[model samples]
Target: MLYDIDKERSALVFIEFQNEWLSDEGILQRRVIKDLDAFRDAVRTGARIIESARSNGWTVVHAGLDLRDDPDYLLFNGGRDVLGLRGAIPRAGTWRDKGVERPAPFAPLRGEFVVAGRSGASVLKNSTLDPFLRNRRIDTLFLMGFATHVCVESSLREAHDMGYNAYLVEDACAAFERAQHEHVRKHVVHHFGAETNGAELIARMEG
Candidate 1:
């Protein structure tokens, strides 16, 4: 079913669109991203969604992961290493020693919110995103970005628990493999929120 999205109380949240995930030479890209072409296509779709949101007066939030000062590398600890790669992944510099810059298409525009201090998968855990949305009176979220089964799914579950109306932009997200992406869309997304693509979402925003 299509949702009646309130432009004033809605936000388009982009998660983990940094160089470590989306760029050609991205550290994580080399480690996990299996289909580069498909991943790039999703990134382009996400960019289009952001443009539509901006034109329609919806809030745009960029949730980036910065692990530079994380003493514990929190993501790998506390049973969070679901991937089981643990020490072999994220490397030493990953998002730690390098800059957390996004690719050109995903860069934040003026008036858009860029959430910081997010070292984990879920954007709301250690970031100001929750408070920022609450302060602005926003309750609906359209989430898109890298690794559909990881960060995007994590945020969706948390958003549902927090009572926010969350929608997953299916085509605007990618995982290490196509099957992984399909798994969340088929079995997981509906449990937390509905699944919509960039085109349908843009049409709703424009309408």
Candidate 2:
């Protein structure tokens, strides 16, 4: 069933659309470049959805990854391997060899809020996002961004548990491998929230 999301009470969250993940020489390029065409298509879809969501008065939130502290858990633990096959999440700009310092196509614009402190996979943890949403009376969430099985999945799971009506914009997300992306969408994410696409979602927003 298609969830009837009220724009006044829903928020669209874009996770980790940073240079380290989506730029030309991004850290994941070595692993995901094989599906670069699919990834780029997803980005285009995401950008369109973002524009429509904003124009229609939906809350737009960019949940960015903050690796500024270079946390030890991400380095020594298995976080590095899971985040990037090359090992470890790169900080913005300093890792020039890894990628250029820039935001991806669907980057946040004026009046859109960029929620930071996402050292972990879930954007709500160690961050002000949850309260921010609650304060705005947002009861539903629409999600998309890099590595569908990682941050996107983690945040969606948390949002569902937090009692927010969560939906994953399937065509607006990307992963290192097509198989990984398909597996998570089929087996994992469906367990938490429903799957949606840009067109259907945009139609709902329009209606």
TM-score of each: 0.88, 0.83
Estimate candidate 1's alpha-carbon lDDT, on a 0 to 1 scale.
0.83
Error of 1 at 193 (Å): 0.7
**Positional deviation of 55 in candidate 1, in angstroms?**
2.3
Per-residue lDDT over 56-79 for candidate 2, one digit per residue giving the tens place of the 0 to 100 score = 888889887654455344433534
Each prediction's total of clashing residue pairs, residues at least 3 apart in sequence or on different chains, is 0, 0
lDDT of 2: 0.75
Provide the lDDT at 161 for model 2: 89
- Candidate closest to the true structure, highest TM-score: 1
Residue pairs whose backbone atoms clash in candidate 2: none
The C-alpha lDDT values of all candidates are: 0.83, 0.75
In model 1, how large is the Cα lDDT of residue 162? 95
